[model samples]
Target chain A: MDGLKKHIEEITPITNEEFDYIKTFFKEKKVKKHQYLLQDGDKVTSEYWIVKGIFRAFHIDKDGKEHILQFALENWWFSDYNAFFSQKESNINIVCMDDAEVLCLTLSGREQLASEFHKMEHFFRMKLTSGYSAQQRRIISLLSNNPKKRYEEFASLYPNIMQKIPKKYIAEYLGVSRETLSRLYSTTSRD
Target chain B: MDGLKKHIEEITPITNEEFDYIKTFFKEKKVKKHQYLLQDGDKVTSEYWIVKGIFRAFHIDKDGKEHILQFALENWWFSDYNAFFSQKESNINIVCMDDAEVLCLTLSGREQLASEFHKMEHFFRMKLTSGYSAQQRRIISLLSNNPKKRYEEFASLYPNIMQKIPKKYIAEYLGVSRETLSRLYSTTSRD
Candidate 1:
């Protein structure tokens, strides 16, 4: 909870009263390693804010091949946002990679805070701005043909995530072959 | 512009006074077809809100192949958002596909309006939410192995843009071969 206050304060200063009210909207939960947080066809309601742990959000194809959409680590937020926002069934699955605790906020709760507090709205807007920017960069990288550049980018932008996530998952996220990733990793180490 | 005012009011209603003040932050510009609104290595300062027209934002690869990132149509906003938000040099290019009119708003102006009016902040936040959701869907489609499914999804989501944009550009955007797109287009039309 103190960390939540610190995180919110990083974007906008919220006093004791505001923090108290805001914190009530979020309920904390513990998650075990390899547990399923969400699954396909589930009605997504709450968006999770990671307090500690790692998780993968992915979509599985008919052939059971998984496509990694994103990874959530400490201080990151994750959910099937489209489902959460529109109150639709989830098309993606989120599974925990490590034992963790997360703070959950329902859509109604999120809206209540935003509508009641102008600063909360600003904070969400700023966060989305950065998220939007990151997606644009990822799209560009996905379109690029340079495998080495892509690997280097992932390593540079998310050193912590890179270290935590396995090479196979990293390759899947980068749209690169496992063999190619291994070669790139060895090459990068030599360099 | 009444269109801009209407667009904003669709989410939140505002008075004549507020609209007048908000409109001043945006400057309208006429764009000619084939004109470059933004180019690689350029400094991005503003995001454009299309009043009328069609445009494609893309990246050029080392092999000199162009990859379409997104298409902007009437009421859509487009820019190298990563650059726009970070005040960095742009790696993407936004070119007008049809003669169009757009309202430009700088980052400073955007922040000013958000701070000055709570409604504006909510409006932008809502816009970003939709934008983020759209990008997530796009990323999923890109990762999917079924080209036909990808083509079908695009056609369904942006039927208007599909009708307006040429087959070549649509093919590039979906990362499918031009020949495959033509076959899909013909198959859909004959249905």
Candidate 2:
């Protein structure tokens, strides 16, 4: 709860009463390693905030190859954002990588919070702006940078993530292959 | 100005007086084919609303290969969005695909409108939500769909874009090669 408090405070000032109101909408849940938080075809009605451990949202292709879209560690929020917001069935699956604790808020609850609190709306808008900005950077990086450079950047930016996730998942996220990633890793080692 | 009126009305109801006030801040410009409205290293201070013709936002890689990010036709708005909101120099280039007419509005002008009009802020939020939703779809499509499916989907969504842009640019946008796109086109024709 301290992490959630700190994150919200960083964006906007929230009164104790306001925080209490907001907190009521979020339900705490514990998930075990290798357990599924969400699976394809399920409706993603809720967004989860990581309080501890790791979780990944991924899509499996026709050939059953998994492409990791996002990895959420402590203090980060994760959801099948498309399905959650659009009220559609999820096309992605979210799996816990480690035993995890999460604070989950339903879409309706979030909307209620936004309508009831102007500052909450501002906080969310700010979050969306920052999310979009980072996504814009990622898109550019994907288009402009080579696989090696992208791998290096990713390692530096999310060092813990790099250590935790499988190499294959990283390759898929970077739009490369396991063989290619291995070659790049060896090339970087030589340097 | 009729185009601007229609565009704003579609987003939110604004009176003629409010429209006129908004109109004063916009500078109308005509761009010749292949000319740039913006380029890499330039500061993106304004967002452009297309009155006529087509525009593309793209980034050129180190190898000087162009990757198309988006296409804007008449009634659509275009900008180096990452640069526009962040007050940063743009890495993306906005090029006119045909002789184009556009009305450009500065960030400050938009901010002023939002401050003065509550409706305008609500309107902007609605637009942002839809834009974010579309972006989420694109990201999911990129990760989940094959190149052929992506091409078909893009064609159906923006048929005009498919007709106007070069195949290579489409290929780059799909993260496919020119050769692969050629193969896909032939296969589709045969079917």
- The candidate that wins on TM-score is 1
- Model 2 DockQ reads 0.42
- Compose the digit string of candidate 2's lDDT tens values, residues B1-191: 97787877886788888888878988999999999999999998998888998888889878987877777888776688778988889998988889989988898887677656755655565556656665655665666667876777567557656577787778877888899888887887687
Kindly provide the TM-score of model 2 when superposed on the true structure, using C-alpha atoms.
0.83
lDDT of 1 by residue, B79-173 (tens): 89999999999998999999999999999999999999999999999999998888887777777676776787787667767669888899888
Tell me the docking grade of candidate 2.
acceptable
lDDT of each: 0.89, 0.78
- Show the lowest summed lDDT stretch of 10 residues, model 1 chain B: B154-163
Clashing pairs in 1: none
Quote the B-chain TM-score, candidate 2: 0.87
Per-candidate interface DockQ score? 0.80, 0.42
- Look at candidate 2 and tell me the lDDT of residue B148: 74
